[model samples]
Target: MKLKSGLMGTIAALVMGLGAAQAEGVKVGMITTLSGGGAGLGVDTRDGFLLALKQAGDAGSTVDLVIEDDQQKPDIAVQIADKMIQSDKVDMLTGIVWSNLAMAVVPSATAQGKFYLSTNAAPSQLAGAGCNARYFSVSYQNDNLHEAAGAYAKGAGIGKVFIMAPNYPAGQDSLAGFKRFYDGALAGEVYTQLGQTDYAAEIAQIRASGAEAVFFFLPGGMGIAFMKQYAASGVGIPLIGPAFSLSQDILPAVGDSALGIKNTSSWSPDLHNAANKAFVAGFQAEYGRLPSLYAAQAYDTANLLLSAMAKSDVADADAFRAALAAADFASVRGKFRFGPNQHPVQDIYVREVVKVDGVLTNAIVGTAMTDRADAYADQCKM
Candidate 1:
């Protein structure tokens, strides 16, 4: 009886040790813009990522997230990245909104042998010659939506257009992308100061530019302020932009001013796909609001990580990266795949802002570009 009892005790100890090993999860550091002007985008990213984990239940337990606020500052984001890597010992890093912040963090973090799964902010630089194998953008490249908008404008027979974006890497990419696909004449192209609230001066320029349409990419609070002021200014020239400025995050605040405005995006609330429908419904149920493109991207990033974790341990860098490259998860954006540069190669759609059931939201109006790949893919050696 003593011998049998001792054997059982040894078995029990082994079982407990196995359980502890299984419970060890991958540590992920999320540094995002959670305060100041761009708080909404970061909040949505965090909420959506958490929602996916919540929905996953036990399967999501494989990931442990250390989240921090970057306050929409490049230096702050870099500092948080360092702390996350050195102190928290994160296996991977994700969640940055602005292109400038991404530019500041992604290169160094990936260089340090930490994988970066970008939630947003896919700058052209990273997509091109500067591409790294350890970096993957779960979101569309910065140029994609602008390219879609440009295509939409050309299809709509708008001959002359005025383009404007914040004076940042993304802003530069936005206008450059619009020009890439836009065959129309440019009346004016203005680069506004990043986070500039008042658009009175730009509005005056637009009013005098005689452009048929205006394409702008002012994200977060900057967009909200611009739209409100533009609407009041009565710059009868129709305004168009990407989903960053026209999504559920900004539409409610912009009110009726955003009504009937055509914009480009890779995902919309009305996109009919099993994954997307579930994501939209789940996000609304979880957060009591519709998910924006930022939220959807972050949610997809989380699921991507979960899928990879299911296949291999994060400590095995090569195997984990291979798992991530496979992208064996249902994306909220439906058809998603990484291009050679590790940026998304997906369809872009045009969405119109419409009051849906007494709330402002976006609805898919048309498909702008299909199986669209960024122009910089060939430049990337990786």
Candidate 2:
């Protein structure tokens, strides 16, 4: 009888160990701006996630990361998010680079009790009244980066600056953000059609307006087409914009035209940090190009999630959420933390576009915005 009882105890212990092992492997669902015109953003997001996983290096953790593409379409993003969450039964969901897409997926996914960690796309609604307890933004609010641009341009003594962006929801938010921080006279605010190809009328308007500087928030192909045409249009007004337009992707195509442009970006390949330097070098070596701000943001977001996972009891969703809320790790941007609304409170750097060794890149010229959060946080009742 004693022998039989001992054997039963051993078998029970083995079963418990197996259960614990299965629970330890983390599962993540990542969806991003893939396919269509903005697929580059997805490539960067996926690469960053994988690179971060490699860096964790035997933190005694395993991850099953399921990735999908949004194709830059709201309907596709919704379908992908629903499928990943339902079919994969993922522990967490992350990485939506577009605000419109995020707006679609967050409510549905968060309602299902899945923790939604947004690596990009900071819709204003999420930060304010529409905030969700299960939804956390790993990146800053949409306005935060644009406000940085405005702050930098204002400090540069840029007077009568012309601003332009696609007349989409996020684009309007970007313009409003810049205008908030820029206490300068407006040359004009031009709302071009979302994907307008021609900048001839805009260029003529800018020339006539005589703005000393130009600020814009055009991402993806919109930015590429605008910059190429802006340069071809002979509009040379000390152009400034967010890092998306001045990104490595668009910069290479624009060539020397990107030079002498001043801008503010959420992330840069040239941040003076060991991790950032390594990330820049390694990503460039592998991909044969410098990492864009999108890449940097996604990379940092992955590390932040990993850091939280490393410190938390993964099986305990509340504990994991708490760890992420605290934000204990140093990001590629040096230091960052979460506001009460779960948006990043981090520094924004003022960078200048220049050709270095025949490569178009931005140099961290100075610090413009530091440890900044969105102005909408005050409205967040969460």
Candidate 3:
């Protein structure tokens, strides 16, 4: 579905209205993991953000976006956040691909009174007691998709399941979220080292556990490595996971090994919405590749900021915050709204990896949950 001409006219009017004020343009700082293991995710996210800005027509006139590579290191992310705030004097900060980096950078930036709009990464702490008024996540909470996977497993009557994840905060959350809804016997649960490529040891355990299915949350190269090894191991158990493990950016690298795998996610390239159709077509035309959930969420983040900026000046923090909370923007995802914790409340779907015109990608199979809010929202006072 394309944006209606009326909506396009509205956006044009908003852009034209920006010229009425003599205020300084908004400055935004983005620190994302652009190198190392999961660089593809960050690259897609960056490209999506830029694509949205480009579509806005002369976005540089109203927004100054400064991007930095975190290199998948929390320390580097912290350093970049400091520079963006102290040197660049950015009014807002966004774009972090990993939960660990978000943990290190988001709180401090928000505490310092800078509005932090997270394109990705939804650490549990930020959605609960650590929630801040200045922070907003355009993506699902880290565990939401995992929880949907759990629900899917239950519905599919998978009575015995083995789960694995990288040993980190987000990893732990993945297991917890899965167990919360998966009312079945756990064959086993294991945590591998973060960024560990070899999974022979884990495969041995899975092979012997008599598991009916397997769920894992390894992203980037780790996922590619694990799937390749699993396929080679000839384990007949069906694989299930969150979208991160089999994202479009990583699916091509995984090849047919990832085909027929089922995963849960809040967005898909084929979502039957006007905004999504436009985004997917525009993304392919611009990058010569299909856009992943990471790219779609980042694209939505840019539109969110632009929508808020159209309604309220960034210099007016309270007004801007209120405007954003209103969520007066068209999301590529058909249904999107922010919960009390500033995280999305949307539908999560079960998707199967399939070839569309011989290109490996995900196809929506069924709805796992609808209008789901994060589990930790009640813990948030704001």
lDDT of 2 at 262: 79
Screening candidate 2 with a backbone cut-off below 3 angstroms (N, C-alpha, C), the clashing residue pairs are none
Q: Is candidate 1 or candidate 2 better by TM-score?
A: 1
Q: Return the candidate ranking by lDDT, descending.
A: 1, 3, 2
Candidate 1 local lDDT, residue 326: 89
Each candidate's TM vs. the true structure?
0.94, 0.91, 0.93
Give the residue spans of candidate 1 off by over 4 A.
1-24
Once fitted onto the true fold, the runs of candidate 3 whose alpha carbons sit more than 4 angstroms away are: 1-23, 59-61
Leading candidate by TM-score = 1
In lDDT terms, how accurate is model 2?
0.80
lDDT of 3 by residue, 316-360 (tens): 788899989888888999989999888899999999999989999
lDDT of 3: 0.90
Candidate 2, residues 134-241, lDDT tens digits: the string is 788877888877898899888878889899987766787899999999999999999987656678888888888889988888787778888888878876787888
**lDDT scores of the candidates, listed in order:** 0.91, 0.80, 0.90
RMSD of each: 5.2, 5.3, 6.4
User: Highest lDDT, which number?
Assistant: 1
Write down the TM-score for model 1. Answer: 0.94
